[model samples]
Target: MAGSKTATLYRMVMPDHLCPSGLKAKWLLEREGYTVEDHPLRTREETEAFKAKHEVSYTPQAWIGDKRIGGYTELRKHFGRKQLEKGETTYRPVIALFTMTLLMALAAAWVATGEPLTILSAEWFVSFSMCVLAFLKVRDVESFSTMFLNYDLLARRWVPYGYIYPFAEGLAGVLMTAKILPWISVPVALFIGTVGAVSVIKAVYIDKRAIKCACVGGDSNVPLGFVSLTENLFMIGMGLWMGFNAFA
Candidate 1:
């Protein structure tokens, strides 16, 4: 057993670049009630020498007593946390976006209807989430379109559709939220949502192809699977409900 809670950290802190992993490692050590002895390699030569001596290729190495805890990732494993592997599929981005939009929708409902829980709240949640998702895609349309072409049948068939998708999604969402122009919004939402659902199902379930989702954004690590399906399903449900009310 270790005598005391002490950790030694070696990280890079160059004049031009401060390593993020190093800062994270230091923070993690402190959070775990360890007194950290931080060693900063301030130069490239120092970094190289340290790497050679330790026979390691990465920075932010930690040591607890005589046991080498490796890098920030290894430190996380030591603390019983799962570190995300490179290129690993994850639902974190979609989960975060939906969770945030849910809160925002509840807040909007409270302010507008004087009640947080209502049918309108659910509608606003889907509408607001769609708008936010569209914003992320349009933020870097080039990158989003490129990634979207990977699995989107419409985008693959007609490349221009990729560029128009974000704007169309945003317009439908805005109209739905304001409860106006159901004729326009309903059809638009239904079309895109149906297409997206089909594309995702074919790519993931039928083809069994591993891919990243462009639902949240281009740079997102969200896996192309259930969350994408859910997003499309929400839009479909909202469109159907709005259409029924508009025509009925």
Candidate 2:
């Protein structure tokens, strides 16, 4: 026991607030065959004092053989774990949104027409996806526009376009869902979809910039790529389909 590996961990363990990362660090140390000297700063005052004393920005600190290991992220890095790297993003959010939208479309169609699966389910899926994406943008319009403007040609040219884009998307989506005037929704969807598609292709493929996508909202980790292009293409297809159906 005396000759075993040893580490010291300082983490929060207050009645009101316990540090999850600290517990994780402790577990990681134990898992790695290290005996940890656990220290709990139980109160806000104690935590502040500890931070000041250590001159560190964050807590859940660890020390092994006189070498200080930082917080959770640092711990992962120490173990050679690949954390979220620069320009590294995920499409999980977009995939989740699309999955949920598809389910919703199917559910709604089944409830209305008593057919669980139908051709019209595709329409519902597109419309619902538009609504969901617009809602997410609405959550942080400024952030969304900042990301949008990164690649959107129109938004870059006309600053107000960024502001109007989300509203346009939401309005078109709602109108489509209500089976309202295709006169409005069709054109709106087509124009925006075309512009967005072009912008995405130009930025991602042409310029070869690995940037975050604003499709599912501003705060997304989804990278600008084929998924983004697909979304725009689907919107175009939906708009065209609806428009043709209106006259035919």
Candidate 3:
């Protein structure tokens, strides 16, 4: 099918700049089993002339048997891919964070106890996840605070709480992970987690005001909903379990 089917691709490859979209388009065409006729406009004048002739503003155009296909995005659509939209909420960031943390936790358990599936692994997973999430928020506190103000009840009331939240989470995570200073860690985690859970519930479930989640970070496209609620619940549960071990 590759050699039999053919595609004509026009892309830009200037002395100073190369078009990434052109490379992506070529890769997609080849992946879809099409033999490609690549035409690269190596100079500014050539690129402009090519564009003027085609009556198109963008490069990396494709043609299949005399039928003109647009740029990389259009090519993706031609192959039946869901077109990506700006500001689309996705769980990919949280999913990736959790997946990486789980693996790290398992590795830690294996190193500590000579087994991967120990009780300590679960604890490590949650703590590691919390630490990473906190780091993301703290990386850009100003941005996170602005987004957090959108739905967090406490942050809305006291703006400083938004800035403080990340450090508090990181502190609790560090103390919990090290299994030291449980008295401080447990209370901190419990208070923040409880507040977060209530705020998420009120905003998403009760009020139904759709917004972005500041859980992963300020710049993420993760939605303010179930995933955020689950993160808060995890922190709450971790706090309770640790408290029982320390106090009860």
Candidate 4:
């Protein structure tokens, strides 16, 4: 009797009644043979505690038997359904647009500073590189396999991290350009470096077989070996230098 089948599912969800995804998941589970019992939980602390006790996190988590499935998207996979895919056309066109916008913004800064093109600072270069990388990532996500892989560990982490990385880079760029908040830039830079470094380690050691970069919104190439390491080290060096000069 220790391994008898159970007909119930326990879901601890962020009680956002307006989320279409959450509603969709609830509907889907009910449609299946599941008796869904939902508990509303908010705040990171509560989420973490629940996860610690139940071994799950992220919104719309599903439990079948003792196994926990995190997020609405993952739940869909377990039930043999496809998750929503980002349209290729929708993402591809925006890449060019954002690239042009970033270039224009950088040009404006260059003109305002009256600094020669050759005199661009490390922060400016790093910021521009990140913007370019982000653009590329967006394009990469449009491919089919990138959008559909079920057990993408790197993608899981990278997608969330990607949301905040751009803002950090942009803020550092602004600080460097305006010649303000020098002290803060160092820590900011270091933070960026640390994230990149951690990302590489996760990709290589922890998620080696998990094919997909997940750095962009969609699935793309798995950045492995030297490629991941080099990218992180470059960022780390940029951050440390930015921090050092800010203090200097």
Best by TM-score: 3
Give the TM-score of each candidate. 0.87, 0.78, 0.93, 0.39
Would you list the rank order by lDDT, best first?
3, 1, 2, 4
RMSD for each of the candidates = 2.5, 4.0, 1.6, 15.7
Alpha-carbon error at 187 in model 2, in Å? 0.8
**Candidate 4 per-residue C-alpha lDDT over 1-248 given as tens digits, one digit per residue, 9 for 90 to 100:** 32242333334454453446666677777777566666655555676776688655445566677776656787788888965554322233334544554565567657767652433544455555555555545454444224423333343556554445545655665565555786765577677667666766765677774444433335444334344455457667766666666565
lDDT string, candidate 1, 38-81, tens digits: 99999999999999999999998899998999988899999999
- Segments in model 1 whose C-alpha atoms lie over 4 Å from true places: 1-3, 13-18, 42-45
Q: Could you tell me how far off, in angstroms, the CA of residue 220 lies in candidate 2 after the best superposition?
A: 2.9
Model 4 C-alpha RMSD to native: 15.7
For candidate 4, the per-residue lDDT at 25 reads: 70
Model 3 shows how many backbone clashes?
0
Backbone N/Cα/C clashes per model: 0, 0, 0, 3
Model number with the top lDDT? 3
- Angstrom error of the Cα, residue 247, model 2: value is 2.0
Q: Against the unseen true structure, what C-alpha lDDT does each candidate score?
A: 0.94, 0.90, 0.95, 0.55
Residue 54 of model 3, lDDT score:
92
TM-score of 3: 0.93
Clashes of 4: 3
